[model samples]
Target chain A: MSPLAALSAAVRLEVVRLATVRSSAVLLALAAAAGAAGAAALCALAERADIGRSGLLEAVTGGSASGLSVVGIAAALAGALVAAGDARHGAERTALVLVPRRGALLTARTVVVAGWSAALAVASLLAAVAVVVLWPQQQLVAASPGPVVLAAPLLGYVGLVVLHGVAGLALTALLRSAVAAVSLVVAWPLVLEPLLGSVLPPSRWGAVLEGLLPAAAASRLVAAPPVAAGTPWLVGSAVAGGALLAAVSALVLLAAVRGARRDA
Target chain B: MIEALALSKRHGSRPALDDVSFTVPDGVLAALVGPAGAGKSTVLRLAVGLDRGSGAVLFDGEPYSRLPRPAHAVGVVLDPRALHPGRTARGHLRSLAAGAGVPRRRVDEVLEQAGVTGARRSRPQHFRRGAALRLAVAGALLGHPRTLLLDDPLTDLDDDSRAWLLDLLRVHADGGGSVLITASRAADVLAVADELVVLRRGRLAARGPASDLVAGLKAGVLVRASDPGLLAGAILRWGGDVEPCDDGALVVTGLDMAAVGEVARAEGVAVHELSRRTADLDAALLSLELPETELLPGANPGAVPGASAVPA
Candidate 1:
């Protein structure tokens, strides 16, 4: 097989790999379930707490105002499992020679992991709609998903899932251990970065901090009360976030190319 | 042909391999045999581009990386950890086959070839050590590569399985495909290889035709006398290479059994025991796998390596 063809095959093989590993399969299922459940809880809360909660459609599509965004956390986890699991298992020893150039192989893995996260995002979205719609309408005041629900929020959700998934893959490649990589993914964005965002002075720099922080930026895309709606800062944050994604991608490629060239 | 030229490796300060070079010609199954830590694995890793070292490993005069589809060029089975714990034998091979663009049916083909078809559905983590090793070899053969680079392939195999693997290797070699198998004790494949590369403490000790090296090079005779020290001296003085074996016997090389007996008779030494001794690879392995204190007296310690050890 040609190198590029071999790489395409590698991606297909990776998907099969992701599917067959019982733990990964279970993790994906749990991620979808958690996302669905979180969205349902938020939809129920939005019915009563109409002021901050927006409406039922918004609540189901976008997550609750407080705590973690379910899709962000779920997608990040799916990314970690897909990207880091193979490296943790030393599967590359057999895999590297099959594709030889690790650039193609790692690129394929990142793409496949992002694709899986995207699928999870779609599933979570469907699951939320299912929960909110299936619930007794007598209990919820604004249970109806208005016509405006899927368009703008769908774009944001897709973007958030993709970005978080990419970050998971890049971080895993940087660390090279699944447990360490997954811990870094969970701790940095969820715990440390958010803590920093809260503690930092409320200034233009704080806005920038909120914009550039991976967790904040990713969560901003899908949060209930959208931060600084349609402002230049959100645009700037998206650009900065994109730039960070680019930097992380460069690092992932660098780690794969340079690391593969050296000792395994 | 496969050639490793001027390969050298170091882990911090200690050398792993030094200026090691050898070739495995077409239709030949070459054995890389040495004691533990003799850099056999290092050579295999460097050859397959899994590890980077000072030199180049060429396949048919091309560096290993330039092959584009390396799996099709060289099938590699280096370690048991090479297989994923969660992946079934079939899943592992099927995925590898996909990457190499080989037919999906080739998975079963290789499974059958490697003798793991019966357990193909089971996760390798649940497999017996021998079965797991076979599953890995099945993955290696998935690409149907022209060369096979195996590291310690015989580690957990019974004699029959080992013989079965050798038969497969013999067929591969007969088809003009070379196999470079790395092992600490290589007696199983020793008689089958066309060439032998003997390494010691990360340096090339010897490399030649297997027949020449395994014959007079390794085979020797042992003699037990009233005084092994005196018998050893007599053999040494009478133009024989003698080493003091802790078995209270003298291991005599560089001379036949008759010559050893003639020397003992001339020296008026009382011969308590005299026998032709051929070193078993298992015995050599005992010397390696055990601690120094648990070893056969002078079996590995203060002992000359390679051909000086008789092989049966």
Candidate 2:
């Protein structure tokens, strides 16, 4: 078979395999639920505190504040879980044994993960829109989703998921164990990212450097407008995060290819 | 034909395969018999390009690395446990079928051939070792590859599965396909192999027809008699090498079973037991162990003695 055909086959198989797992289904369900709930709760809290006489809170929550956190967490989890799956199931070896072309295999997996993450991102966004439209807030000025706002969050989510997925893959490749990779994935944003952010300077350059961090890049997608004074910092942080993730992914992919070639 | 020329591989200053060289001709089943950690798996991996080594693995007339869709030319079942646990047997086969460019119907055909048709829908995680091996074989057969390189395919198989695999490989070789298998259970599998490549400590010990290698070894018949001392002298007088066994018997070398029996009979020695003992692959492997050698960088490791070296 041609390399493209082989890659397509590998991707299809990976998607089917990932979909069959109980963890994947549970994670997706939890993400949808959490995103909806977060959006709703935020909207309610904003309604209760009538200091802001605007529909901005409703728009931020996508109708319900409950879904925002859920969407973020779920998308992040999906990326991490897919990366861990390869090492956990020993499918990485099988994939390498078949293709032996590390680049093609990584490309296929990236496509699959990105496709899944994009689909879920859109679904969460739509759910937020639906919840907002159904809400009984007549005073809230529900602005239609314009091109910039829509594209920003969607692209942002894509970038976040890609960063997480690449990190997950790199960790798994370096560690050669799924549990260890997942543990690092969990610990990085929760512990390391916060610690690093606090120590780093609060300048535009600092934001750029922080953007290289996974958590900072992911936060860029959720930071709503009332434009903060440090907008450049946030944007820099997002770009840095993407660049760091891409660089790390390339390294991990190279290592994985070398390892597979060294031993079966 | 599959050729591994001057192939050498090392792991962190320790050599795993050292200057190993051998050729498996088309239409013949060859067995690489060696002890554990003798680089058997490494050889298989390098042959299929799953592992990088300082040497060359050529399929038919060209290097395997240059082949387009290598699976069509070389079918490999390196690790039986490498299958994804989440996939069912059928799903696994179908996925490989799609990749190998085989018809979907061949999936069922291979399943039936492998005796895994009944478990087609069962998840691979639920399979026993034999079932897993059968599935692996089915995957290797998907594209009807001309060469099958199996590493310890019979490691955890039952008698029936082993026999079935042997017969299957025999048929594959008979149909003009080359089969190179690595196994420690040489006596069982080597019986069907046309040639035996004996390896010891990452070096080729012996490479020739199975019968020739077995017969060439210092082997003979074990003759049991009431008076072992007399039989030993008689065999020695007849220009045969004989040694006394623990149980009042003489292990004679350089003579066939019939010759030993006839000599004992003529010497008025009553023989209780007389059995032919040939040197097995394991014994041959042990007899020819070599000291480890550091692999030179960018050298053709598998180049046979005096063979022209290919630039690494």
Top candidate when judged by lDDT against the true structure: 1
CA RMSD of all predictions: 5.5, 6.1
lDDT of 2 by residue, B124-144 (tens): 887788889999999888877
Candidate 2's DockQ is: 0.34
What docking grade does candidate 2 earn? acceptable
For residues B157-213, could you state the per-residue lDDT of candidate 1 as single tens digits?
A: 877677877788888999999899987776766767777786766777656676654
Q: At residue B242, what lDDT does model 1 achieve?
A: 82
My TM-score estimates for the predictions, one after another, are 0.84, 0.80
Question: Which is the leading candidate under TM-score?
Answer: 1
For the candidates in turn, chain A alone yields TM-scores of: 0.78, 0.71
True contacts kept of each: 0.63, 0.31
